[model samples]
Structure formats: structure tokens, C-alpha cells
Target: MVAPGTLLLLGPLLAALPGLGQGQGQGQGRQRRPPPTQSPLEKVAAQEELSLPQLAGKWFLVGMASHCSYLAEHSHQLEATAVTVTVLDGQSLAISTFRKLDGMCWEIRQRYLPAQAHGRFLLKGRGYGSKVDVVVGETDHSSYAILYYQKGRSISVKLYGRTIRVSDAVVDKFEQRVSAVGLSEDMTYYFPTYGFCDSADEFHILDETKP
Candidate 1:
């Protein structure tokens, strides 16, 4: 029972209405500081001198923390998710996420275009679709990865493991990052260890590819 809010890996970018207003409105006769040039998500540093090839392989989506209302309400119905990352043309990433929706395995494909920064990427939506900024905050190239996704002002942090289970130390690190982003432990949800789907048939694939 996936939430109508979650489009699997796409998160709120695919479900929520486009152009939702963000930032605090300035009241009449009240002075407000100018906004920073970069967003809060952009301020978070990416893995320095990241090697994209090392990130290629199957990874289990073990943890996620987001403030999307639908996900917050239906967090318990989260499904087991897995992703296979492939480096395309030596820079960009071709990602295929597998999960079960209504008991049927499905594949969701996405491409992360490299940004000016080494570990930062961008997922541009098609047509009226919204854009998502992606950053690999931390990764050891073997054991675990902590990634951040932001669309507009909403941000979601994800913890990926080389295997289904990661060490408690890693979980602690993930929680710390989550809290740093103003979210609490209650907003974090862990995926199931079992019932992971390796692949999905062609008919069940949702390709978010650029023409």
C-alpha cells in the first residue's frame, strides 16, 4: 500500500503539485534577511572527489526521512525498495529502482545529471515536472551511502546499503544527518529487509528518461 504521495524514488517531485510556494512571507513593516544564494540542500557538502564507478551496483533502500504529508501519514505501508546504479558516459548515472506496488513488482528508471560539484547531481523533470537536486552527502564506496534529495524547499534524506542491513554506527550517522536537516526520528522510516524485488518486467517499468 504505497502512499499516493510517493512515486517510489521520485518522492514528492512526482506526486505533489508543481510550484508550491516556499519561504516565509515578510509581514507588513517587518524586516527580513535576504535569502541565501544557494538553497539549504545546496549548502550540504557532497562526497569530496567522489568516484561514480564505485557507486555502481545494487543498493538496498534501508532508510528514508521526509516531510511529505502523504509519506508521513502512510509511512507504515512503505515497501521494500532496491536500486541498481549504472554510470553512463563516465559521468551521468542511470538508476533503476525496483519495488512492489499493489503486490506487483515495478521498475522506475531515472537519470542523474552531474552538476558542477563532483558528488552533486540533478534530476530534471520532463515538461511541467519539477526538478530535484541530488547530493551524495557521504559514501564509503563499499558499505553505505547517505544521499539527499530536494525539490523546491522540501528535502528527503536516504540511506542506502550495499546489503540489506548496515551497522548500527551507520544508522546513527544517518539519524544525525536527518536531525541536522530539522527532521526528527519520528519522520524516519526504515524499509523491510525481505520482499525486495530484483527486477521488473517491461510492462511494469516507469521510465523517467529524457527524450
Candidate 2:
């Protein structure tokens, strides 16, 4: 069986949920909070003139922040994930993610089609049945990168590092971005630093190629 964290690697399915501002312990008598004037996507901006070559190679999934109810509930079950990037024709991106589920390593391959924006891309298929908007919001192309994923109104932020551990300064920057998107610190989760699956057998690979 595919683990919940595996599904998380592909994309978090969007579902109807309360606003981020609304927290627990608020009763019916408590005043309802007003929603943010700006949507999560609006708060994020992609990097311009993204250098695909510099971004190619292996990177570990270090941290992630999302308001997805499922993720919030299963945060403890997070897995060590790593992604490898390959620049396709200097325009598109070929991504392969490695993670373990049920004692077996699995590899998921997907292509990110370039958008009109230099650092933005669109992901289609993979059983989600809808296009997911992906933006390379921030990355040094060497040490660490912060990416944003959006499907419909749901948005999530991820921090990736070339190594298993990143500096505290990088983590602070990631948290700031997460807050800018209206998500709180409580919604953030750090992935394991060790035991990253570097490869998967042919039978465990799920290749979602696009033409």
C-alpha cells in the first residue's frame, strides 16, 4: 500500500477547509475571524530568469508547511524524501522523487511544463485529474531552495537543501515565507534528515510522462 507521505510527494489534494486564521478552541460564541484579503498564491512571487542548469542535481526535502488537513493529521508519519532534477532542452524540467513506503523505496517521475513565467511551471496528470501550478519562488541554486505548490486555493511551501541539513538562517527564511502565505508555524513539519531513498527498483517506479 502506498503511504500517505507518498501521496504527499506527488501533491496534496485540495479539499474544503476552514481559514488558516481560524484555530481550535473557538466556540460558536467566539467571534468569527475575517479571512485574509489576499490569497496564498498572491503572496508568493517566483524567481525571474531561473537558471535551470544550476538547479539540476540531487536535493533533499528538508521542510514543508501546509494547511492541508490530511497533512496536519499525519505529520508524524512524514518520510525522508529526495528529488533529482534534470533540465530538459533548457526549458522544461524532468523531476524524479525518491521515498520509501512500506519498507520499499518508490520513485515517481513527472515533468513540469514551462509556463509563460521564467520560474513558473504547470504539472498535469498523475491521477490528480487537474493541473497543479508550481513556482520556484526562491533558490540560490547551490545551497537551498524554497518552492511553492498550488492546486486551486490550497498552497504549500517546501524547503530543499543540497545536503541533509541546512543552516538555521535558511530555516528562518522558510518560516517567514510560510507565514506570508497565511500558514502558522504549527502547520509546518520537518522531514527526516537520514534514511533518504536514493533509488527504487523497476517495479516500484511510477513514471508519469507527458508529451
C-alpha RMSD of each candidate structure in angstroms: 10.3, 11.9
Specify the highest-TM-score model's number. Answer: 1
Q: Which regions of candidate 1 deviate over 4 angstroms?
A: 1-37
* Cα lDDT, all candidates: 0.89, 0.86
- Candidate 2: segments with Cα more than 4 A from true spot: 1-39
- Poorest 10 consecutive residues by lDDT, candidate 1: 15-24
Tens digit of per-residue lDDT, candidate 1, span 41-103: 967889986899999999999999999889988888899999999999999999999999999
Score every model by TM-score: 0.82, 0.79
lDDT at position 83, candidate 1: 96
Looking at candidate 2, the ten consecutive residues that score lowest on lDDT are: 12-21
